[model samples]
Target: MRYYYAEHQAAYRRLGREGMTQWNDLFGESWTFDDFPNRVFLESVLDRLPASGEVLEYGCGTGPAACFLAARGFRVDAIDLIPEAITLARRFAQERGVTVNFSVQDVCAMPVGSKQYDVILDSYCLQSIVTDPDRAAVLAAVRDRLKPNGHYVLSTAMYDSDRVYEDDFRYDATTGICYERSTEPADDAVQLDNTWYLPHRRHLRPKALRAELEANGLQVLSQQGELRGDVICTPTRRG
Candidate 1:
């Protein structure tokens, strides 16, 4: 697990340096790997949040959503594990004329001091942290940083009902890790080849995801979508 976490960190650092630019060039600036339903759902709900509040965005890639929150009157602090990503996010925030505290920090081991947030947003990055314990640590950190009435927004891919492995990818049942080897090879930031590989992707079952959240003291208040699930959670009362 430690080795995989190290690998994950290294992969994202490389991706932050190269993959992000390649993605913007290949897919254009608006090229986000988001499903329309989830994206729409998130924007609609987030936009309706109180005009002013403290917000924390975990795994904020290049700062679009974080900027959006900051622009919407929230005191925003966004963190990403990759230093290059933080650099890009800071530049993007500056370009957008919005203020965001963007920092290079690990989600599992957040570096926040006594500060807490009223809202925490997780957009598809929770599943990227492959190992169960690591994911649990992140959830616990979120619990610790959130205000009593604070909410956590999570969006993630759902496991296919049939559990059929796509030609290019395979899900390991034992480790709950999904690995990919692309057949249509091309020069890309995340090289999906025999030797080079992309980061681990986890497609979680809705029941399992909810259970884990509950175990971490988060209670699911609502959820939306099928192919991709967007859930809102609130911290549960502790004895």
Candidate 2:
């Protein structure tokens, strides 16, 4: 399967869960793609955000946090590889009466532009990357796009001591990806090094995650929450 094709399917099609379009049930029984807890995750890092400046958010599925930041007076540029997701995000921004720069671009190949941002937002998107190379590339892009004093607000799944892997899904400790390896393989099972498995999520252990970030020239300033939490980062000067 191609990268982000599964997510593209998740955009317009129903996963047969809460409702439609990857949103959660906020009220009673409904799914609004424009509204989700991911925005609340963004809000958790409010104290880290700059007063006013440009912010970059990668893998912004429907641009919930992007729209929220724009509404809060920050110039936002949100990107996701899925074109359909970006289309939906643009529509959602219009509905919210907020202006956000939403584009269909892969964060792994993020451009090195002259413009640097005040903040780079992860918002649980980092764990979805699911591979060492891709994660490294994306983190490098985040550091490159951030200003000297900019913050990298990251939220991702961490494999703590208590986290458990389900029976059906197989967890690759080395890669941190949980694969859907059922009796009947999924139609869209992705092949990595000739192994067919549909990656559900990636959980980075705290120690390794910190090392990876530091290797990519980002130093964690503070962190909060539990298994899935927010981390504030700043660029580390390399001699």
Candidate 3:
């Protein structure tokens, strides 16, 4: 089974430099934690952040989100698994004169040296950890990195039912490894266009996710369905 780290590395390579440029073009300004303009998911999360506090954004991509938070006067730390991504994010922050601590480190293996953050933002990254086994360790690591009363906000796709693909799917929740069979069609089948290249699909149901959080000592502050999108979970550390 492919580990989460390996899967992410492949994705990073796929994005390469061109993908980063595309992201900058699409977002215009640096991305923020709760960035979507009219989405209730981000709006609710933004409402929870302190005006100025220590913030950590996991999977910060090209650093747009970290830059945005820094511009707002919050101390920000952003991390991504891709070295090139972190380099681009650092350059972006430097050009914008926004001070953000950017690093290339796996969130599960972060060497943060016992530091805890006031808010941890996981904007669509957790869904990438599709394996059930890896989820526990990742959640535990996140919990350990948060301070008392710290907030965690995350958005991820949810699946209503089980599915099987023409290809292979493998996931391990213990290590958070998620693997998928290639979407390529077999011989004798009609040549499928790459229009629908679904990379991975392991979704956490809202009820199940809430139960997981509570079991891990996180208190759900508010959870809302996001405009026909995935459910957003905003939870606070138990004091």
Candidate 4:
């Protein structure tokens, strides 16, 4: 495996081991909060989708959005890198009596039929891939699996302002990746913070992100926010 892939896998394995003993509120009931902005953004974007669309939530940690969409009558498939997270998501779906196909899979190598989904959502997960090539592979996979004209919803951490990465985090100017790493391994609770588990992250400027997405066949339709960067785009060419 590549170094980045191995590093991410090991870190998440540690996270799974940690979650066995304690629950991080972020992936637990914290999703139940009514004002969760991601949920709000998702709910507001339903107008762009067809009725009862088939949806795929890539990197769907603990399946909140999957369950939410399933509850709203969409067919949902949610994939996450961590088995523990998938287990928790399945249990959460059962508790809510909502059906979501939760699978333990890596986004870079997704095992799904092409052109099967009407919508694909990546909620701040693409940056976790860290490297440009890996991110491109994921975008290609998403493009291949989306039906023509299907919407691709992306949420990412953007570093466009002077205040963005001024907080002592490490920034790689060559790659446009910004991150902070622990000298030693962080404990389970610490891993609950996405940065703790997947420490190597790519925080892109909006222009760069747009270029990458467009290069992968998506055309930007709408974009919002400098911090919680949300983009709504569609395939520029037939899938």
Best by lDDT: 2
lDDT of each: 0.71, 0.75, 0.62, 0.72
List where candidate 4 sits over 4 angstroms from the true fold.
1-37, 160-169, 179-199, 226-228
Query: How high is each candidate's TM-score?
Result: 0.76, 0.81, 0.70, 0.78
Tell me model 1's lDDT, rounded to 2 decimals: 0.71
C-alpha root-mean-square deviation, candidate 2: 4.1
lDDT of 4 at 54: 93
lDDT of 4 at 35: 33
Candidate 2 off by > 4 Å: 1-3, 15-35, 160-168, 182-195
Task: Using TM-score as the measure, name the better of candidate 2 and candidate 3.
Answer: 2
Candidate 4 lDDT by residue in tens digits, 115-220: 4689999877777777666787898888888888789988877765574554436676656776555444543212334444324678777788888889889989
**Candidate 2 lDDT, tens digit per residue, 1-239?**
54446655564344233334443432345535545555666776677677768999988877777888899899999998877667767888998899999998988777777888999887668777766677888988888888999999887877766777776567878867787653445654666555566766778777777778889999988766666356788999768
Clashing residue pairs, backbone N/CA/C < 3 A, model 1: none
Among the numbered candidates, top TM-score falls to: 2
Residues 139-161 of candidate 1 have per-residue lDDT tens digits of 98999888888989887766776
Candidate 1 deviant stretches above 4 angstroms = 1-38, 161-169, 173-175, 179-199
Model 3: per-residue lDDT, tens digit, 73-146? 88998888878778777877888899999888776555536888887877567766654545666677677777
Error (Å) of candidate 1 at residue 199 is 7.6
